[model samples]
Target: MIIHVVAIIMELLKLINTFFESALFKKLINRKRSLNYIQFQRADHFLITLSKTCKQ
Candidate 1:
């Protein structure tokens, strides 16, 4: 029946949406981690420079 076909299509769409949502969530998490790492490296570099200047 048409109703069954429509129901199946809706389920497929829901599954696809769930998959994309998880994928996007993972990408966002990775981006945040990379950003944090970059910030940490910059802070470390600044501290090293500050120490060298103080020593000089």
Candidate 2:
């Protein structure tokens, strides 16, 4: 029973490691980075627009 439990734990760990190494995981990370970048870009644009409107 203990050996079976250990085997299961190792399998789970391997699965988790593979998931981390997968392209899907990398895409998820990159997606977050891009989202952050887009948010910053949007904020910069909004600030610039606000300043222009205020000046006008």
Candidate 3:
């Protein structure tokens, strides 16, 4: 009976760990995507500025 209880507890812990890790991974991915988007926008602005300067 004790062994069964321990096994169940271990399974529950594993499931909880998995859930947390998935959530953390999704958060990281979203952060990375946002960073990339900002960087791209900055690059686009820089290119526009360079083109305008060249035109002058």
Candidate 4:
């Protein structure tokens, strides 16, 4: 019984490792690339706010 449990655990670990090695996992790791537009908008808004504060 213990051996079977260990085998199952190892299989699960292998599957998780394979998932992390896939392209989807790499895309997830590069998630910041997908947020460039959002980041740019946030930066523009911040600059606008700063300019407004400075003017006041």
Give all candidates' CA lDDT scores: 0.63, 0.67, 0.63, 0.65
Model 3, 1-56: lDDT tens per residue? 96686567556656754764697756865778777657755865775575466446
Q: What is the C-alpha RMSD of each candidate to the true structure, in Å?
A: 22.5, 19.7, 22.3, 18.8
TM-score of each: 0.42, 0.49, 0.42, 0.53
- Could you tally the backbone clashes for each prediction? 0, 0, 0, 0
Question: Over 4 Å off in model 2, which ranges?
Answer: 33-56
**Where is model 4 more than 4 Å wrong at Cα?**
32-56
Look at candidate 4 and tell me the lDDT of residue 37. 45
Global CA lDDT computed for model 4 = 0.65
Cα lDDT of model 2 overall?
A: 0.67
lDDT score at residue 24, model 1, on the 0-100 scale: 76
For candidate 4, give the lDDT of residue 5: 68
Better of 1 and 4 by TM-score: 4
State the lDDT of candidate 1 residue by residue for 1-56, as single tens digits: 96686567556656754764687756865778777657756865775575466446
Shift of residue 8 alpha carbon in model 4, Å: 0.4
Candidate 2 local Cα displacement, residue 50, angstroms: 54
Q: Which ten residues in a row have the lowest lDDT in candidate 3?
A: 47-56
By TM-score, the better pick of 1 and 2 is: 2
